[model samples]
Target: MNDEKEPQANPWMKSLLIWVGILLALVLFVSMFDSSSRQPDGTSIAYSEFLARVDEGTVKSAEIAGNVVSGKLTNDQSFKTYAPSDPQLVDRLTAKGVEFRAKPEEQASFWMILVYQSLPFLLILGIAFFVMRQMQKNAGSGAMGFGKSRAKMLTEKQGRVTFDDVAGIDEAREELEEIVQFLKDPSRFARLGGKIPKGALLVGSPGTGKTLLARAIAGEANVPFFTISGSDFVEMFVGVGASRVRDMFEQAKKNAPCIVFIDEIDAVGRHRGAGLGNGNDEREQTLNQLLVEMDGFDANEGIIIVAATNRPDVLDPALLRPGRFDRQVIVPKPDIEGREKILAVHMKKTPLAPDVNARVIARGTPGFSGADLANLVNEAALLAARKGKRLVAMSEFEEAKDKVMMGAERRSMIMTEDEKKATAYHEAGHALVSLYIPGCDPLHKVTIIPRGRALGVTWNLPDRDRYSMTMKQMKARLSLCFGGRIAEQLIYGADELNTGASNDIQQATDMARSMVMEYGMSEKLGWLRYRDNQDEVFLGHSVSRAQNMSEETARLIDSEVRRLVEEGEARAREVLTDNLDELHRLAGALLEYETLSGDESKRVIKGESIGRDDAAGRRAAQMDTAGSSIPKSRRPGGGWDAAPQGA
Candidate 1:
């Protein structure tokens, strides 16, 4: 059943075979019809018959063409014969009164002779031309582009972005100011017997101005900046990446005192040999070349390499060693004052009303980065424009902020009265629990409006950014997350509890599981964190099937997670039981207005104006003290700090 068709021959081969066949056929026909072969039936009276026919006047017509003579007999018989060099051949033909003609010797056509003579030379020349063109085309990109560096050079003319242009990362800027000084006055450091560090790395979460700080360094140093992505160092070709690495360093050497910045450096700088999967040979070669270049270059050469990546944990240790990226500057999310500064910087582009204070906006955006602030300002301006307002007012900014956090108001998403009441109660329950919990984030806003995939949203914005979280706050958050489901069970009974709190339960379950497995919060696990050692360099997830524990440990982990969730639910129930009247009041307010701000929520819950948040308690975070509720297993030397102690 082999139905495969045989492969066909090349068209040129087929055409050449046909031409050869035609030539052979012509040769065979010429051999078969050669004038030297006498016909089988013809009489062999060559010279005598020719003389007799010429004398008898039977040769009616004759022609002498070069060597062979052809004539027609009077009886209409044709024959071809050669003529000897007879001086009176023409006179003899005239005497016999026979019609005869002699053809002049034919000369070869000029163009035909030229073609036959030059064909070989023409073929050779055409082949050479085609081959040379193909070679040049390949050299242009197939070979040449592989060896050229892809870095873009930004000189003083293109980049004027100094440290002033960046905000919300003051610590990083200060950390890099020395590098700037080193680049500007290398001799000063040299005279002091201090060698400038060859490299610095910027690491942080996305949108935290990591790349911006690198540009700011180049601007402040007033040096040529070579900008490229870590990916630009890699190519599909085997040796191209290594060649590019050499090329880039050579260019940087030509422009001494320049700064080279590779943004998103994890693309080529992942840990070697044993992290996520088997290492890539091409990528490894490029990395090796980079290592060689870094070692070969002198620290006093005044060229600095600054790279940025969000995944510093996955970078190779060899890259971060001393004399390489010796300095690691952290660019974190903005704090209250930093957010305020960033907003003011972005607000300079837009006309704003006096009532729209940047500080107020900063207080509301605790974890916002400089980029987020810029986006927020843009959204506010867009809202103002949509309303044809001359200036972006406080109301517009507030609406935009609300829209950013909870998503755009879905007024068109119609709901029955019962569904509305259920959503209202659910949101109010979250706000109410957070209000009573001492370590919980301050309850900011609650709304029953549908946004994204949620039926309602409850915002709990901290007054400031936090670096860590404590066990007490985590447990409080777990209770706070499940408060909606608890509320539904309390008001509508277990049978009537809908799927609105399904997302809440799932979140609570995952948090509890993380506390047990990754955070070492379980007593039975005994400070043993069951987390994968694998790290993904490119932000993709990695799963390592390297569990060392037995099935019993897994079951215990599941049991512990369930206990945490149940305990949190019981706590929520107790809190709601004691303040049923307040919960009802909050739910009622939500039903009427469909939204409640921090002040309104506080008034509904505590019957008082919104006062200062628990900053005093927050600043005195007792991570190691007995006052902390985190399990000792979870708290390694001490507990995790839930907040920036004095920040």
Candidate 2:
């Protein structure tokens, strides 16, 4: 890629240039008028001296014009003087035998006179107009264009992205392909008595590529595309949003058979009167105009409206009705196969090593979306470049995945021996519990190294993509959550346990409560949902969503949640007590290695070594070669850096 230089002129420089031009024009106009009124340069004397000269007949030939007089002396020298209101001035010149001639007074041309009169008004008007233009530009549109549409027309010159460029979410893509087909050949649907869909609503979580799908439709149809955000229509003043909506539709009608994509429609299409107090009148009015444009009495045939939003629940019902948004397409997180395809698409741009397997990476990231896969590929390439590698290897991809999933490792943070010991035991407890539990996910890795905000982490991997959880799985997960606390309690006395398990305790409690209240998994709650649906913070207190259950029932709910938690804690303690030796062994291995993969952890629990002697020997050799200049505490086998050389 080539580097581009910045333009020579900046905004302030342009403003300065404009001011300079204005000043120059004012100077030129002033000079024109000044030159017309200025008196001729010549010798000047008083009116009395001029009269004496005229009486002496020294002024041979006097010339008079307006309020000044100029003539030549008898010696052929020129002189000038101001004349008073003397009626006999001309007669005196005549009697003096001065051969005077009275020239007609000079007058400006008609056009020059008009210019002198109107120059100041023109300058004022020009300045005012320029200032207004700058203000309107800052306000997003010109002064006369507040009501005009802000939708940007997209063309091939802007870089076209077609359906071929989109990957994953095939079902959503297939749903929209029909709209593209109709756009290309409206007669096919028309001949079959089928009317084209007025609009298609793309709903999904953020980063699911709803906007990308809209662009693909425009590219496939080969028609004009106008893109705008929902907030673009809204203004602080009332009626402006409505006018913009009308104007946007007008532009779309002028370019018939085009697509207009509104991103984040929930910004303007939120349900009216849902919140407490007065709603946003301007936003509501804009939404009303948008609704009318989509499905009102006027038939906007040949025009297609495509809108995307993550928060569809907050959108007004009128905007999502049959005619307005005829189809609702869901863009969900990609599954394993979809992930492979998405990774493949992004990997095409990256130089990959032979060991980089898209399938393996896809299986590891079960719930990744198209955007997430793209980011993963980018991060892998960046990691390879940072390491000065020619191509991205599988190890780089794995490291990138860890960074994206659990955050980068914080090796610079200092930890005491006691802290590392406690963290190792805590993570070991969770891993040991997961290994013993019936329905727990398989343990992937356990580490005592600080990462993100945690002192240690025990990661678990599901065998496949799981959409729902069984009651057994939920109970097992609850036990897994408490295992860290239970291990801490067993290693250190209950009173001596650290705050390492605070998050674990909170997560377990919430899960247990959700199982009872929301999932209706508890016998006490039966098969009915005890959770409130209304978002109180969103709707405010004026709208009541309080569950009408009695105080007794609330107390029962609390007791049930506590009972489930206690049961999980008891189960975790039982497992840890039975496998006390294995817990100690795993924790000791973590202290030695600082990290253990699933297989390594299993081997450690089984009383098998993972070949650490060779790595230790290599580190000792490097230290010896470096001599005694290095401090013993800061050596390879010292302090927190005591891990094996290449581990």
Which lDDT tens digits does candidate 1 get at residues 310-424?
9898899999999888889989888988898888888888999989988889899877777778888999999999999999999888888878766787789878877877787
Give the residue spans of candidate 1 off by over 4 A.
1-144, 156-159, 275-280, 297-300, 518-525, 532-547, 605-647
| Every model's TM-score | 0.70, 0.78
What's model 1's lDDT at 23? 64
Candidate 2, superposed: residue stretches over 4 Å from native: 1-20, 23-126, 132-140, 276-280, 538-546, 611-647
Give the per-residue lDDT digits (tens) of candidate 2, residues 388-441.
999999999988988887778899999887777667767888899999999999
* Each candidate's clash count: 2, 0
Best by lDDT: 2
Per-model CA lDDT versus the true structure: 0.75, 0.82
lDDT score of residue 241 within candidate 2: 92
